[model samples]
Target: MTEAEKFTEYTIPRKDTVYCVEFCGTETSSQLLAVGSNSKVSIYLCKFREEEEVEEFEYEQLHDLQNGCRVTALSWSPETSITCLPRNIRLAAGGSDHRIQIFHSDLRGNDSVMVLEGHTDFVNSLTFDPETGDRLASVGDDKWCRIWDKDGNQELTFPLSAQGMSVCWHREEPVKVMVAQKNGVIKIFSLSGQMQLMSFDTNQVPLMEADWCVGNKGLLIGAVAGSDWVMFDVSVSSRPVERRQIHVEGTRYFRWAKCHDSLVASVGRPGRQIKVFNAKSSQTPITLSQTVTYGLSWHQKLPALATGGDQKVHIYMFDSL
Candidate 1:
């Protein structure tokens, strides 16, 4: 590993085996939400400082999804977007039932806002357009990417040849959604009035996760099953501008830090390591953990990280820059 690939400091005892991790909150107070296969969700609240210990909170019983459906994906509403209110912010999750469920968080508690049903196969992933909170996208094993209004109305549907695992909105454009399929292809299409622009045959490996970086100038897509991750300069071309292949120790989960341009985290392999990388270089990844990690997430505002794998959820603060 090169100098930049060497992370400075890290927290100990990383998360155990987890199903998913999400970063929530506005630009100020941030929190990490993790979902476990054991039919529970864990919430960790803390300040971001690197390498320091952080206070943590865990919500193991997410009574919202009553049927015990696993949370396949998560998203937060834009603070300024009128699509959802502060207390009325919405979270969308898909699962084995082929349904998309929305949970509303309020001063009273978290409750099911609505359940979207239509897909004929397992619902795999969901993406909310931060630019236009009204629009949301979902992909599934049925090989179709569907767009829905926040109110649960169907907008559009695009068919692909591979299983759709993840989808994301372009930073500079709200109407455009980038759909990642298991066959290693990323399709970009508009979800505004009609299905405007569409592109296919984007990749050759199965894509497990797709995320937009800090300002949307770049996009990160990963296929942890194959230990391959790629970065794209949105303004340039459909081809990835950079790519990296890391040899993870075990079954991997690939994710980019929520609000950071240079940090990506994953839990898998030899010892459940949290590997961090600079997107600009795609060099040898730096291992950042001393324990097994199942899932990890970055805070939107603070420099801290929240991870959950074992029976305990941990919050770690980065001591300094």
Candidate 2:
């Protein structure tokens, strides 16, 4: 289970260097979308069918840069009309312009559905509540974490010491959200404004990204300075949890796979590498050799993976033995 694996690789073939990526939900798996310095976003629909292990071909592009922002961070909405035909997926993206805008694929002009203005700095991360799509958590260089009611205008803000680089929401409880600080401190708080539950320090390593595993029982955190990853059992910590370092290569983004277990994915330097690990594994994790890797996301309904890095988006199949 530790052998390095390369599923599929393709240069997204973009006009500029890519910075971020996300997956839009489909009836079975999901679609891959990416953003770049060209100030444009590219959406590549995933084409998967029965007995398929990888993507067959790139489907039609949803929307080009003609309307969307540079798209620093993108998230797919889980809430949609069940009776609607060709279900329209909703998405939220934030970028260098410091704006959090929402859009629905069914809308004309790709108009901005909801424009959220609060962060004084660039919005770097966005995460939707898995339980209820009515709420979202965002982090930014403003050195704070903000939670906004997906259906209302009330946003709860929590200030931290360092610049906010990334954010994630707990799976079971929609109110708990995690914020990663550029200074290497990871803080967990409740959307109810209860209190900061746990905090972990990475010795100022400056974690550019982080995520909490489903059930909110475990957390996976990565840093830039130390080419390593850390796992924390938040429930075991009284005030602040001491992070357990899972030594690996330089990691850039941290994401918890949407699968049924504590599966996690990361893309980082030292080279264009993608690694997947089981939080419950007593042994170490297995790294996948990707020609270039940047973003990692899991499918909602299938054992499929969507990743980006080189020049294109790649789709892979994941199965546990």
Q: After superposition on all CA atoms, what RMSD does each candidate show versus the true structure?
A: 5.0, 3.9
Tens digit per residue, CA lDDT, model 1, 1-321 = 443333233332324345555666455324434344444444433333332354442332323334366655556655422223444445676766687776665524645557788789987777677665677788889999888876898878888778887777756666677777777666677665555364433354545655556555544443443466666655567676665656443335666665566666655556666666656663555556545454556776655566655545555544333
Clashes of 1: 19
Give the per-residue lDDT digits (tens) of candidate 2, residues 183-298. 88888887677689778776646576776665445444333335656666665543333344443545677767765556767677657666666656655555666666666677
Clash tally, candidates in order: 19, 5
Once fitted onto the true fold, the runs of candidate 1 whose alpha carbons sit more than 4 angstroms away are 1-18, 32-37, 40-44, 48-67, 79-86, 196-203, 216-225, 248-251, 267-271, 282-284, 288-296, 314-321
Best by lDDT: 2
lDDT of 1: 0.58
Global lDDT scores for all candidate models: 0.58, 0.63
